[model samples]
Target: MSSSTSSSEPTAAWARFLRLLLLFAAVPAAIAYAFIALVDPWGMLPLSLPLRRETVTTNQRFSYPMIAQDPRFDSVVVGTSTSRLLRPAQLDELFGARFANLSMNSGTAWEQAQLLALFTRRHPAPRVVMVGLDKEWCESGPLRRLTPRPFPEWMYGGNPWRGYGEILNPFAAEEAGKQALAMLRLARPRYGRDGYADFLPNDARYDAARAAQSLVPPPAAPAAADPAFEFPQHALLAERLAALPAVTRAVLFFVPYHVSLQPRPGTLDEQRMEACRAAITRIAKARPGTALADFMIPSPITREDTHYWDPQHYRIGIAERLARGLAAAAEGHPSAEGDYVLLVPPVGH
Candidate 1:
């Protein structure tokens, strides 16, 4: 009876061990199937479907095409959407230099520096890199952290998977398979263009004209003026400017803002603006080949409600005038002075 009992105990132990093995094996297989079914073929699973407003378009259908197609650009524009008004074609015509606009919406100084590094790696360091300075870019935060995924360097350069493992986890063999699938076009490229260009009045006016509607609206009320805003991010801006290769000529321009929408008196906004201007002034004085151009003057054209897409983006005519002003400021630099004047608009329009 004792022998029979011992034999039964051994059989029971074997059964339990087999059950545990099957459980472990089955769990992974189930997860794998689910991942295969739900994850996009690119090894990227949408954090949220129906892409949000902030998603950086990763596919080559839009701005990637612009970068890939233009390999000979001798100049590049780096800024947020505020600088997007300055078109590459316009700058190329004015400066006689091949150019590309590397501007993105809400792009932080860190991202801009990274892009500059990327550009220097591939192309000849641009002869002139016009950086647009706006008040909001000084705000603290990783500008793209709230989006579905961190901004991928692949959006600007090739190698989508370059820094993937560092930014994401759950690195698995299945993910490798998925990436292979994406390469073969079996999976959709996991990004779409948010209408960054849509904010420009040029496209708005075109759409309005096509729809047989007038684009102009009535004049807007005067914007409250804030004279006290202090900008702390200018230090970061200075660091970035200093790090640029000696071959690159950098120009920082404070883009115009509609006076009608200016901040109120004694507000933090005014203080911040003052700090930024002061910081930029100091930077220009210290840097050998750097210059500043301030174009934030209120004019009849700029004060009109229709002149801007919102409070910051200007119409095509205004953008053209500003670009020409920038060209003039850049050209006016003397060969020996190592200093350039900041050009402000003439009084009263």
Candidate 2:
């Protein structure tokens, strides 16, 4: 009887140890999950909990998907760094539609397509899809389609189940925690709700010598063919938007690159720019009502060094002018003579 009692004691102790181990592991796991569900930064869960919007971290890969899915905005601004200057509120007043700028750094054409696809799929058809046409829009071949980083396919897919992994991720969790803490203290967000923050100094100081240096391309044989470029996708973008039920306006504006940035006439760069513009123009003419505002052509705005800080990026004032001009053109009203030429269909074609 004594031997049996000792053996039973060992068995009971082992069971107790196993239970303790399970409890220890379960506690932290449960706590983590609870925190994630409560914070819900990625909007993966259906809880509709209010986020600390004041703590707007610049997480475009995550934030953009949320914005695109949101039903509040009826228009989207898609482009690269150059497009960020166009304020959404200003655009809203100009175009008579709620707009959200989804532009990011080095945003490629393919990335724009994915973003547009995501926006159109999850939310109601947008009334307008304004594309800021840049050199990236004219890219062709494998290199042209590739973005610097892979777009988060899972996030863009609009599948809540698939998003759990991103939602509960360590990085996401850390950001969520920070956001919660910041909310308690009323901290300001890194980026605005419009997803814009002026990265450059507002002062547009003119230095012609400095600007001219950027104009010179790398040494290459004069006979060497210009890098391959194609604009079919840009045209396709217009066509696709025009096909959508709610899409009444599809505006493609050539961002106002300064004069130094414009290639010299009869040069390969000039030829390439014309080719791209021609392709886009053809599409605009065919579609009718699609506004083609060309700023690439040497104009008053382009020639003015005061309008641009760098060779390419113009200042906010230029963006304001563009918004007003493009808006007027879209509405069939004549825009004031300025840096850009607005050609609404048959008139320009």
Clashing residue pairs in all predictions, respectively, total 11, 0
Deviation in Å, model 2, residue 324 alpha carbon: 1.5
TM-score of candidate 1 relative to the true fold? 0.59
Cα lDDT tens digits for candidate 1, 1-349: 9999999998999999999999999998766655443442332333312221222233212233335224567777777778876867778888778776766666666566556555555664667778887755545333432223256554445554443332233443345344445555676433322112434434544442333223233243343454433444556567766766676666777777666545444555555555666667777666666667765544554455555556667677777777777777676542132122374321111
- lDDT per residue, candidate 2, 7-121, as tens digits? 9998999999999999999998778867876776655456635754432446465567667777788888888888888898899887778888888778777777778787777
C-alpha lDDT (0 to 100) for residue 335 of candidate 1: 19
Which stretches of candidate 2 lie above 4 Å from their native place?
1-26, 51-55, 143-146, 202-232, 235-239, 332-338, 343-349
Give Cα-based local distance difference scores for all models. 0.56, 0.70
Q: Who wins the lDDT comparison?
A: 2
Candidate 1 regions off by >4 Å? 1-70, 138-149, 153-232, 264-266, 333-349
